[model samples]
Target: MKCIERIKYPEFDFKEYKASEGRHSVHDYPAMLHYLLVNHLIKNYSSENSLIYDPFCGSGVSIVESLKLNRKAFGTDINPLALLIADVRASNFETDRIRDVLDRFNIEWNNLTPDIPEVKNISYWFKDYVIKDLGKIRTFLRTVKDNEIFKFLLVVFSQTVRDVSNNRKGEFKRYRLSEEKLKQFTPNVRKTFISLVEKYLKIVETDIIPFTDFKLFLQDVRVSIPIKNVDLIITSPPYGDSKTTVAYGQFSSFSFDWLKGLNPYGDGDLKLDSLCLGGKKIKEQKELPSGHLYDALKNIEKIDEKRALEVYSFFYDYYLSIKQVVKTLNDNANVCFVVGNRTVKGIRIEMDFITAEFFESFGLTLENIFVREIANKRMPLKNSPSNITGKTSNTMLNEYIVIMRN
Candidate 1:
């Protein structure tokens, strides 16, 4: 089947796609679109036993979809929190064992005292009581024996932190909630944890797949995969520099705080460009005809002369790393990358085209580009217009899925 022919599901609709049932339904991203894309790739280019891979498997959407369709799946991400999530979501757990562990955790969690003695960033976003309750749940998970069950519960707890905290209903900027709003819905931490766990258990029971093989990696995608040549690749690489697009680490810092051993601010983690206001190096870099972004010290009137050179050097080096991975693909194998364009310094950076150009150097031909609208993704703050580019729409309505073949 041709790519377009395979994707032509009679039931597909953008509004209904947003409301479709599955993991992506609760979170952001169109699950139907991903499902359609995955199905198309598998049917046209992959066998049932083909090794499917997602380099930026955020929350393991592709991995889960692959298993649901009975394919071998592998995924990688730089965020430890994301890695943990991907691990649990894609794992084929024994239902009975998962239920037993969750029940035990709940029992022990209730008996423990809600006292988080050493807090980090808790005071800034959560009330004292909420923090105490959250700490108690974390304390119990620390003692759980089954690593799979423990990690699954950890994601559930982490997911709830945003809702129970002072920042539940605010726009996707930083965690800035009013005191009155915080008091309105002071979610009992223990109660919320139990509810989330129950929901997860119910989902697992209903949707668990018993015979799928999956692996999760906490590493940058620019490196080589430990496995031999893969049969297929489907991923959405980070848009622009990590610093400028979104502060994924900062967004999920609260959960990382609870997962004590995990490092949210580790060295290899990408530093956000929004927070960098003014430094010398931001001025000197050459602006790509296609508005590729770079991390520079914020608040400079123009790009810093010295810093621009350094930032460009860093970007090219990263691109070379991605190039190495592309070169490792099996002959005639197919790769699909979900990416989008962005504006930098009031210029449109056609990332899709630039990425096509990059991959072509490795003998991969651009087959097709499909545009999907991501209307639900978090947008820029209303009051804060982008300093470099003045446009202020928050929704990422325009997206591109670039297909390539060796």
Candidate 2:
């Protein structure tokens, strides 16, 4: 209830800053947090060696930042690709072993008969020769015995998959290129993969440091129990279900398919978006705890009842995730939920206010909400929420960082 009356959202300049810079450039994660922002939050809210947690740690930005700052970090996500990317980022690798392995892989590449992966509609997304080249790389990776080395190679391969795919660039959703574009799109998959591997290797050689206390899990926060005594929680939760918002699963579908052998979520069922918050339909809708949410839901329902149900389901799941997260907080622990106020049927949902209310419902005190411009967050500028062509709405231009304490 306190700090709720004087709610002033101050704008911060995050446009000029880079989120996927330096070592963080290992992979291109959609809508990743700025490294500077996560660093500031971790340093300001917690002390050295304290336990930090991120329930929805996309690409493990918070995990990598926390480990670098000498904090013990824990992160979880439903996306298998997210876990793999996060694990690779937080891990320390030997440059000599990597270089030696590459040398060996190059020698074996010419003689190796690449078996194309059983990714559904593989040809649609990749050219015949390109598929063979990627398969060769995956085949080479099987010879790798070192776990860290294998993970690093997987990250490189994942990036290569995205680059070579017919999926349109600069999009989180899966949209294949046009026939003309596909004909003109001839990507050197092998070169791209090697170049990326070397690029990340250079970064690892310089930025490699040991942080043994970090942990990354491929688990849903709503059901998984986080480690206790968490001193700080810094995360950017999904603004809405992946289908309506950023299709994270769609974005990683190719990578996930390539890495399916190691995928924790299993094979064939690549419904990452469906497994996300409010990804599925609910049997009944109930009034949530926040007044802001209630008003927004009513307004959206008036326009379209089905869309409102989807909205309600996402928040309900979000609330449940928050409940599990709150149980792990230590006394006086700090929490930061970076979120966006997305529009549905032209009705803006005040996610920041509702987030504050959810924390308050769980006996946490609201501190502040910092509004930052989405200078470089990789998201579409406009979306057709009504599903009507030419009827588009502007996505969130700013993100809200809601601070609270338990």
Candidate 3:
């Protein structure tokens, strides 16, 4: 690795520092950026121990940032992988168990081997020897008595899977490497995992506070969220359905495939991406809370009614999720969303305008809509919005913040 400093971000006036100690760039939305929002907008109730909630807490950046500021952080998501990361990232470490684990693993590294679980085309995703090593690490991790250490270790393992897998890097969707590339490539899974474990452990030791109040759970925002009297509801939610938006499910499924067996959960958790906003099917909805979306759908209806219906369904689900967020918040509390409006069939859907109007319908006054150029993008710059070839554009160049009051 090389050391560099003073990188430039176009127009986002946020700080340039990092958040989590480990390489926790699972999804972008830096801590300093979030802290800036929390500091600037949330003036009414900025208590040190204020209850902060993020309903659609993808990767738990908001929740983690809240904890860092000595606030009570809580978040809910459908994906167990996200919960695991959030729990590990937000929680401060206690004992030197990680050191002990690392010491013992140094001696047992060669002897240990992976007990690979059953997955579709596992050979294609990972090499045979890599599988063996991963299985061994899994076996060793099972023997670990401490649950807290185990969770952080899972982050290391998850990163290892992503790093060593045949799936092309950077792209959220999993696509196996070409036969020539696969043949030529060789990865030292054990070394990489061990290095990451050390890095994460150091982060826990030096960065995290002794104790930070946080609760991360696997729950759909459209259904239920166990938070109340929330001081601030800040989140950068899923843009739309994961299929054409961002392949968060596909990005997480590889790691989750290995992790799900460690605990007892069904295939429902595996469908986290599909369970995202607008994941389900529905008819074209004209009965919209916001006229902006309805009009956009009308324009889209002329082009492709099927895709138009998809937008309606997504907003319908989004509307419900926003309602759930409102129910859990205290009176006069604020809800802010850092959302990117992706184009469908090359039509720019104004999520910021739509969200502000929808929130107004819920009796929440629209505070302001702040626009910022996306400096650190987690997703690819170019993509097919309609999931059809030749219908592509620059997706996340700019992001909008829709702030509303309860």
Candidate 4:
């Protein structure tokens, strides 16, 4: 087989890592870009000690690959669960230690009575017995003094909640089971939780954390970042509002609410789905320098004004976020935004073109745009162009890798 560093563009295929499962399933990123683009950006800096930062790290692919290369990685996300999953992914622990924690919990499992945590409309999301078992998991987790152990157990518990909740599997937004479907559905929460815990343990044994240090922050990139002078950035920003493009908030809500229910702000309390790029409104008086985004918005407005507003709002805040991230980069440092151009009301929103314009306005130079077919990404497969309710339309199948430099 050819050596990894020697593999070049067009020749490399995602089939090599088709087994991108397990913890990888915790969030979505183009598996190919995570491997290829990350390596490509690392090649920019000659020093092995260079810092790699991802503001919108999502599931932490950028950080993980940076560590694999023995580089110090720093990442932050507005979503706490994303940070938690990234923390679990980057966790440095021996298999024996994890197994011991679980074994100890199992021994004390009989003594602890199931106690449910408070959640908003708890009954609407879970069955009573499922709630009891979730409480059992939370109670046991609270007893573990080790932070690493606590985080790993939390991942298992969060996954368990998603699997057993009334929400349909794979749907981002919370949707209750139909009355007929509810009549027949039954999930054994305790058994499912234990099985998932064991499954994650096996994955832990095989994972190797080669890097020595990493810093993960729970903050919004649109507001502030804790670190500065980042050498490189590799991130996949949201395509549009969470409501239309991707329901990141919806996808993560079940797990987030459970974490919040256990403790108001200890785990998660942000309305992430609604707090993202297009989540809130921002006024934009100046016209975009490029005509593409402007034209698309006008067309969308003629047909669907609500969607037009969502797109406008997303770009307005997204522009500010890009401005903030650029300030943290060193002179001549490279930034790669792996993004998709999704359609709304049959008009394509050219994120690549728009991103390049934003970078230019900030006195940065556009390097190159690499187009690649997205591979090994799990999406709902179809989404409506004009509906926030999610209608059937052709989903995003390709992505643009827009690389820019200061």
Task: List the global CA lDDT of all models.
Answer: 0.59, 0.83, 0.71, 0.72
In terms of lDDT, the best-performing candidate is 2
Candidate 1 on 140-233: residue-level lDDT in tens?
7667677677667777777777667676453333456766766576677777776777776667667776547988777655555565477788
Q: How do all models score by TM-score?
A: 0.79, 0.94, 0.88, 0.88
Judged by whole-model lDDT over C-alpha atoms, candidate 4 comes out at 0.72
Give the winner by lDDT: 2 or 3: 2
Error of 3 at 221 (Å): 0.9
Q: Report lDDT (Cα) of residue 243, candidate 1.
A: 42
The regions of model 3 sitting more than 4 angstroms off are 1-12, 15-45, 263-270, 284-286, 381-393
Worst 10 residues of 3 by lDDT: 1-10
lDDT of 4 by residue, 1-406 (tens): 1111211245323545652554454433222244655666676542587888888887787787788788888898877777788878776666687788878877987787765666789888888878887887777877877777777778788888888998765555567878888878799887787788777777766767678589888877788777898888888888887766656676776777677644212465437767788788655545755566788899999998877887888888788788889888988888888878887778888888888888788888887777766555555433454354423334776767777888
Error of 4 at 228 (Å): 1.0
Screening candidate 3 with a backbone cut-off below 3 angstroms (N, C-alpha, C), the clashing residue pairs are 113-136, 114-132, 114-135, 114-136, 115-135
Worst 10 residues of 2 by lDDT: 385-394
Clashing residue pairs for model 2: none
| Runs of candidate 1 exceeding 4 Å displacement | 1-13, 25-33, 114-117, 170-173, 262-318, 379-395
Model 2 stretches with alpha carbons more than 4 Å out: 1-11, 263-269, 381-383, 386-394
lDDT of 4 at 304: 82
